[model samples]
Target chain A: MVQLDDLDRAILKLLKQDARLTISELAERLNRPESTIHFRIKKLIEKGVIDRYTIILGEPLKPKSVVAVYIETEIPVIEDFLEKYINHITKTLSMLPNVLAVARSGRNGIIALIGGETEEQIEKFVDDTIRTLPSLRKVEVFPFTNIVKGEDVIGFLVDV
Target chain B: MVQLDDLDRAILKLLKQDARLTISELAERLNRPESTIHFRIKKLIEKGVIDRYTIILGEPLKPKSVVAVYIETEIPVIEDFLEKYINHITKTLSMLPNVLAVARSGRNGIIALIGGETEEQIEKFVDDTIRTLPSLRKVEVFPFTNIVKGEDVIGFLVDV
Candidate 1:
């Protein structure tokens, strides 16, 4: 269990905003020696504090992160929807091969967000899957056109 | 903006799992002295990397972070939805206060995951407002009972 001191908390907060800062730069900014900064970072990794680094890959590109969207079905459908359905849906969407995350939906119907390299591919994925899911009475598919606050921004950092 | 070095990222990753770690304890675990660890943390703070410290508040007792929810509406509705409607929506949900984030559904609706204090508040918010919005035809609401992978966990040293 890691109990964050103010400094640790601060370091985390900064990175939450931007994740590419250098140690010497951080050291200079912190008025500390480069060695001190470097070692502190090394410690953080050994403790499993930092996870892996990732790149945000969309710029009018292959659809987006929510390649696989979840169509929300009403509560009445939960009985029909099962864990097996997840793998099944993933495989089903695999036909299109572009969708990313497919969970359940929130409201009345099963929702699936299409993700693909081209507009044509995305359209086909939605069409094929619409016929596949039987329990689905009405399917409302929404393609992501733009990003507001992405899934990546949601964090749990503590300020110093 | 917070830029994370390898260490800062590690610290964030570890803390997400367990936030009760002590300075010296972290130092020992990470193989650095407490002082150096302390310095980087300080820099992180001054840089505004860390946001704020908050308790998870437990899933069983507290309102969990909301995940799956899709609001199905019409896109032409966004023009009006963005005006008095969207701002009010943001204000109302923000007032209810548990909602972590809200996104435009891309289609006609807004998709969001709400972390409500109680089920009643969430249900009431949707039900009461449903009929009021003329453009909103079928407002489907789903309360998230489980989390696939915590969005907060992917975050690093800053509060990610």
Candidate 2:
């Protein structure tokens, strides 16, 4: 089990906001010695607490509208094909750039986040591509009108 | 409109994978001169194409179970209170550490991603915190059995 002290949590919080912060900058902000900050960061990475450094894209690259499409496939008589069918759907959805994320819910369901230029476009894509897929029983689209929390997710998940 | 040529897109893609990559490292990988890579990165930052550098926490800090909860509120007769009611709900959910993301869906709906130590904990949270809220028409929970794409989202959105 990994136990994080107050200092570790604080360092993580700061890095989550801006990983580019130098050891000196982190030390200044946290009121700690630069060497201490450096050593802690190294340990965190080694322990697999800090996975990797990355970037969040800006508005220019993000889509104007976004929606989460939940699709539940009707169970087939064969039963053995359920996993294959789900895999196919997930793989096909994963290939599309507009589909930011794809996940399986239970044995017969798939949930995906998709983005487009407008609400109409997203709806159309869902209707044309997702709904038309075979064996799907339910397709629900939840439009993201305004994100109050974790608002930058679209930017983080958007493809360059 | 901002236009991204092949070189700009390539640089952005590489940086998205590893923002900590040095200019020389990026140049080496992209087969471009170090100076050219530096100049392009500078311009990308200036143009707001590269929003900000950040970090993704590893699995140790991320929740073991995740779910997307979709809640739809019943439209009130007064009509004017819907916005306030929705805003109040979103703000409240946003304050909780377990609620990873909150987004408004149309006028009467809100979608939230939540995380917990176990599936039972997440269910209990929804039953206690979400379903008990007034004027809710529907509450749907989609458990993430397997994430095929954007799997690190929970780690990225998890609070320190």
Candidate 3:
């Protein structure tokens, strides 16, 4: 674990909120000297604490509806076939623009975040694109009706 | 829907990769004048396509294990009670640092992304903190063994 003082945490919190803040602005807000703020940020980057800077695209570009789908593939007779099948499914989903995120969940399961213009549209895509895939044991869809925390994630993960 | 020309999308894509890029750099890369790059970025910000600049924390700060949990509450005799219960559950979970994200799945269901140092630790958290809650109909945990796309999201959403 990395050790972080209160100042480091404060700077990280501020930068996470708005990375556009200049060193002088951060100094003024945190009551630290400009040099200290700059040094701290540099150290944070060097330590790999601050991974990267990026932009979150806002509404109109963000999907109006999002759903989390859990797909469980049937265990094939050949063990090698199951591993290959899971890899193929994840790669295929990752290439699609509508599939915002994809991950392998345990041995025979995959979880994906899918986005669309409407609930109906997303459901149709799930039924047509996902449910149609062969050798799947079950597919469950969880629609995000209201995001209470980390709501900006959709904006962060959406494709431009 | 917001209209985005090829240039706007290209600019957005580059910025999304690295928001710290200077206007001159963007211009040089895109074969456009610096003034044009500057103008386009300004317009993009003004139009709210670029929501905000942010940072993604690296490995040490990010959780080593992550799981997506779906919690469904049992419906009560009073609809009002169910509404308030769901709200209360979401609010409580949102306040926890380990609960990376929380969203209402439906009238009586909640979807939360949880993080911890290990899978066992996260399971303990779910067993102790979440499953203990009264009136839950079901609790499902999906472990993300491998994230194939949009994996940086964990870094983006993880709290300091």
Per DockQ, the best of the predicted structures is 3
- Predicted structure 3: lDDT: 0.96
Docking class of 2: high
Query: Candidate 3's error at B112, in angstroms?
Result: 0.4
Per lDDT, the best of the predicted structures is: 3
- The alpha-carbon deviation from the true structure for residue B85 of candidate 3, after best TM-score superposition, in angstroms, is 0.5
Model 2 C-alpha lDDT per residue in residues B1-160, reported as the tens digit of each score: 7898999999998888888999999999989999999999998888888899989999898999999999999999978899889989999999999999999999899999999999899999999999999889999999999999998888889998
lDDT of 3 by residue, B69-128 (tens): 999999999999999999999999999999999999979999999999999999999999
Classified by CAPRI criteria, candidate 1 counts as incorrect
Residues B1-160 of candidate 1 have per-residue lDDT tens digits of 2456777655555544554466677688778888977787666556545433333322222343343345554445347554556445545544444455556544455665555556676776566654466656566555444323233321321223
Q: What is the DockQ of candidate 2?
A: 0.89
RMSD of each: 10.8, 0.9, 0.7
- Which portions of model 3 show Cα errors greater than 4 Å? none
What is the i-RMS of every prediction?
A: 9.9, 0.8, 0.7
How would you encode candidate 3's per-residue C-alpha lDDT over A14-104 as one tens digit per residue?
A: 9999999999999999999999999999999999999999999999699999999999999999999999999999999999999999999
The model with the greatest TM-score is 3
Q: Which residue window of length 10 is worst by lDDT in model 1 chain B?
A: B151-160
